[model samples]
Target: MDFLSWYDWITPTNPFASLFFGVIFTVIIGITVWIDTKKLKTTTLAMIVGVFVTIFGVTILNFIGFYN
Candidate 1:
């Protein structure tokens, strides 16, 4: 399957995969927010960090076939 096909499966067609990815995404976001809070003490900054970290992390995982 190509990237868009895989994206469709994980995003909507498969509930299990969606939930699994959601949990991993949430965990990544939570960790980034926690670490950023320690340094910046700013919710907005922490949220930004979390979003970027999660996006990059998921992209890397997908590239490595972890999400396939």
Candidate 2:
């Protein structure tokens, strides 16, 4: 599929989906910012690893048509 079509297909349209997506991003940002401010090297590293893991897991699920 083309980029636009894929984007349109994946983009959240329902209110719950939008809220969930927003909450996820907000949490990620909040965690990263909090860790940065605290200067906790181990937690920062763990968060980075976790974020990457989550991204890869979501990407795999998307490719497997789980979202559909």
| CA lDDT scores, all candidates in order | 0.56, 0.56
Q: Candidate 2 — which pairs collide? A: none
TM per prediction:
0.43, 0.46
lDDT of 1: 0.56
Residue pairs with colliding backbones in model 1 are: none
Segments of candidate 1 deviating more than 4 angstroms: 1-41
Give the runs in model 2 whose Cα sits over 4 Å from its true position: 1-39
Candidate 1 lDDT, tens digit per residue, 9-66? 4453333454446555666666676676665456456556655665676666666766
lDDT of 2 at 45: 66
lDDT for each residue of candidate 2 in 1-68, tens digit (9 for 90 to 100) = 32233243257433334344545665677577676786666556666666665566556666677656
Best by lDDT: 2
